[model samples]
Target: MNESKHNTQFLGLLGQSSTFISAFSVAQVCLTWYVFSFTGSAVAVGLVAILETLAALLVSLPVGTLVDRLNKGMLLAVSGVAGFAVFLILSFNVLFFSFDMAAVLMLAVVWGASREITRSAGLSALPDVVTSGTIAKSNGIYRALRSSLESISNALAGGLIVALGVLSGFLFSAGAYLASALFAAFILLPFLKSKTATHPSGQEKKPSMLEDLKEGFRWLVARKGFFLLTVSATFFNFFMDMIITYYVIYVAVGINATSLVYGLILSALAAGDVSGSLIGGRLNLLKYSGKINVVLFGGIPGLCILAMGIVPGIYTAILFTFIVGLCFGISVNVWLTTAHNIVPPNMRGRYFAIDGALSSISPVAIAAGAAVIALYGIMVDFIISGILMVLFTFVFASMRSLWKLDGRVHKERPANEAT
Candidate 1:
């Protein structure tokens, strides 16, 4: 009965999360499209995306701390409701009031903050919503399915905006949030929903926010293996995002591919990723140990990068991009699975917040990458980047810290000690 209840709650949580991400993706596209259509400025479009993200990152620490201090399930619902309110206000501002860029930007910030709340709360709540045995699968399905949904949502966004109008677009996103809130409120469990943050054992006073944040930092640093994994994760996110940021220029200018061909290439990448995520979710990727699995998947992407740069035709480029996506996608899901299982429930929100903060600075890498492309050419950039990635990634298979994360080393230790 307990398993059945957890499964039921997981389904509801999935519904709530899917709608949240799908709506945000589509709404962002619509919002950016409207700004571009009216202003005819690429900078304005970029601003919309950047500001929203910036707002979220600015609030990440506080949001994560708040998530830890509250009932995570209820917080998720609150996030949904808050998102709904933001979209509705934006809709009214655009539809009735005069359209002001400042107003739009302000609301975007609000939406981003609300979205971050959901993110932190959801990550913290996920472990409790499903059995430990399904943690890997749940994490994979949650992310991969959301990615697939976002892709589809963005694909149809332009058509929807054209046919339905931008006001309708805002309302549509608002409706998604409303639906999400309903699912969260009615179907999601309130398990661990209260402020249960523990201080030092036998202490009466709760920690201050700074103390809580400091403790989260302490928690990560105290575990050397996990700290290494966190650094590895940050490096992967930085490098991978840099690749994505520059990939378009390579296709559009370097190869001079048509928009249709480019679209197909992206589709292929997405397909490979979704498929690989499903595969990773189902298998015990640690069978060869996490170290070997990480090295294999991580290094394969480097080879794919080399192939993508060296391959002559658009078709060949697409194939290698697909391979890169597949390998990287698997590595990502495996790490999420492993991390989800390892993080203490009380620390998940703060841990992920710190992780996210590390990722937020990744845009700096694009500047370095851009300099390389400008001076060395995109092909040279790819070659150098791929070689470095391979040299470093082909580097992880023997990291005993990873082996111990899953107890492979611990099991051997017991046997050796017994002998």
Candidate 2:
């Protein structure tokens, strides 16, 4: 495939992905508001999150294997269709019937499964659609566009819910998923086929699914730096979840903010994400990725959250959260691009899934955070989470092996040997 054709097709896929993700964000916001309205407790929100994470965790390994074996475009289309169906059903129920917690929990499980499948498949398919040299830029573009759309959708969601009710949000969510399915089928699948045709085949026996799973684990274990990075990320997710699980509640109850304010705060964060992703793409951070990771991922985000805890004002908290989003946006692009540079195409799906599962440490963290909020209050939990995040940065940064690691140096090796 020519570079122009690859870029066009990749952009099409990304556009559809961005649209669906934006819609999902809107639906999520509406659902969160509904849950909070009904239960009036942060613990209920935490429980919902835990259920979703548990469902994703259950399917991660199997979905990883499927993503590697199946056609990536087809897998993404299926995921979209599943999301559309689920949301459509939810919309109908919400319109005609009363809100049912049990039904919502079941839908969350299905929704979470579909989300994980699509995300893994999309990330795994990126290398197949773009040249290696352009991976970081392409990833940055995708993130920037997605974040931009999310900002718009989240801002719209608050008004839509207030004016037209939650059913409208669910309808929009269903429509977006349907569009994603159509786009994948019509635009991405054909290009993927052409791309595959251009590659020269080698006669090698395919591994069993179990073998593939084991290989992914072994690859991560062999690369000490990457393994440690994953571990550090797991802890980061744990601490971050403590804050995120109750972020909206904190704004609503703690700071006495309204739904519009909640939406505006999220929009600010997404705007910052867009800025960071674009900037990160322009910088050459591969050589110093290790140090960059420690600062952007841990140092900046920790400080931002710490400031939020101390200030505890809506305006200041929004500024701090936006900065946190900006830093993480850059860190995410760098980390993902580095992974693409090192991981082989054949193993990327499983590798990403396993890494994703590791980071799905939200369930326990949400439970603990909710308990703390119940006991002491949101401020105490925020302060504790911020402290832990800052402390972990030093721990991650102190590793001499990780600091000396360079992604560009590793990129030269064959993927198998690089691990």
Candidate 1 wrongly placed segments (more than 4 Å): 1-6, 31-46, 85-105, 158-171, 189-202, 243-269, 287-298, 302-318, 366-388, 391-419
lDDT, candidate 2, 84-185, per-residue tens: 988899898888888788888888898888888888888887878788778888878878888898888888888788889878888998999999888888
Cα TM-score per model: 0.78, 0.94
Runs in model 2 lying further than 4 Å from the true structure: 1-6, 193-206, 409-419
TM-score of 1: 0.78
User: For residue 162, what is the lDDT in candidate 2?
Assistant: 80
Clashing residue pairs in candidate 1, if any?
71-193
Residue-level error in angstroms, candidate 1, position 382: 6.1
Q: Indicate which candidate wins on TM-score.
A: 2
Worst 10 residues of 1 by lDDT: 410-419
Task: Report clashes for each candidate as comma-separated counts.
Answer: 1, 0
- Residue range 287-317, candidate 1, lDDT tens digits: 4435634564557777777776676468788
